[model samples]
Target: MNTSRGYLVIGGLVLAEAALLFVPVAILGAAINWPESLDFAPSQALPLIDGQLGQVRLGYGIYLVYSLAWVLIGPAIAWLALGRDKQVGPLFVVAVGLICAWALARAIGIIRWLTASTFLAETYAAATPEMRQTIDLIQSSVNAWGGAIGEILGVSLFTVGWLVVVSLIILRNGGLPRILGWSGLFVAPILASPVIELFGMEASIFISTLSIHLWLFAAGFMMVGMALFGKEA
Candidate 1:
């Protein structure tokens, strides 16, 4: 495809992904105080799930869609990059690879909510104290393992890697506004802030979330403009 057409597609996808973030955020945030709820112990979390299983499932189901869409954006960005140069650079390859890993890890993290957590919630609701203890152990393990893959690996690391690489490419290529590129660079470290949790420090994920949302929103519009009017300084 031509560059304008490519930008159109990529821009639209970026904007859609940015907007789609709100669905799960709003739904799960209301249903279970999520994201924060993600950290709740089984005794606390299971009850919320038991009380609002439908909302929890619905929120996560939409989240699954959002996460899977992340995969598509990778290839779209790769396509745009390749169209510009007619060859893939190491950065492009790395960006696409990280995006794929991000999508998969996020999906794995979300699947627990839809499938395993539902069962655990139901079992916990009726379980005796001993059984509840076992359930707690199982749920905690799931949260730790899945959280590591999804939150730390996918959201924090892989996504940040993609942003940094892509931003550098944009800065060099002038495919989008240079300001957008700088903004991406500015946001990349903040996006990776959640990774600090791995070191036993509390991550202000809210700040990261706000930074990324603003960056994506800005980039999305810039891309659409580039599509409509061609590249600009």
Candidate 2:
């Protein structure tokens, strides 16, 4: 329960969480894109999609299971590393709240993506020329409004909430350098904003997401290193 050992445990858990992200990303990405490939040629990819969906669902479920581990274990680890005198109660409460909000936002985003993708594929395939024109109008309306709502509320809430909560933890605990935490906070608002207006024009989902993942990985490492190296201070 010394600082060094505490850090190592938390750091290891963080890395494990990062590593687990790849499972669902790989599986779900394949599942989402699999149907598109079916149009190119007669192939076995359709079945693969079905199979991947099962895997993705299972992987996502597992991910959710472990989501609480870090937050719960982290404070305890941090307490031991930096010493029991540190006031980590607020940090713990914030972390838990952020995790819950993130989980809810993620659920909303996934539902939106799945619903939109399925509707587009089914509706587009079945429509006659006249129906297609009508449906196109509907689609435009839906996308314009629905997409805005989903992006703004679902995605933004999760991303920004995560950035703020994680940054606060680091800043409060003095676990990692303050600059990285500040940088994360700065990036959060950009990631949360719509990618159309001038302020949000330069935003790239890929870059933003990748950067967040990298920060999590680094934070995890820092936690583990502190646990394994630091004395009770």
In model 1, which range of ten residues has the least summed lDDT? Answer: 77-86
Q: How would you encode candidate 2's per-residue C-alpha lDDT over 1-233 as one tens digit per residue?
A: 65466567667876787777666566555565522432332123323433455554565455455444445543443343233456657655665565555555455444533455345445556567787666556645554454344445544665466567656665666556566578778777767654453354534555555665687687676666555666322
For model 2, the superposed segments whose C-alpha errors exceed 4 Å read: 1-6, 27-83, 86-95, 134-151, 154-158, 175-183, 186-202, 231-233
lDDT of 1 by residue, 1-233 (tens): 77787788788888998899899889989989987887787899999998999999898999899999888886675455444565667878888899999999999988998888899999999899999999999999998888888888998998888888888877777656777778888899999998989889998877887888888788778778888887644
Candidate 1 yields a Cα-based lDDT of 0.84
- The TM-score leader among the candidates is 1
Stretches off by above 4 angstroms in model 1 are: 81-83, 230-233
Worst 10 residues of 2 by lDDT: 38-47
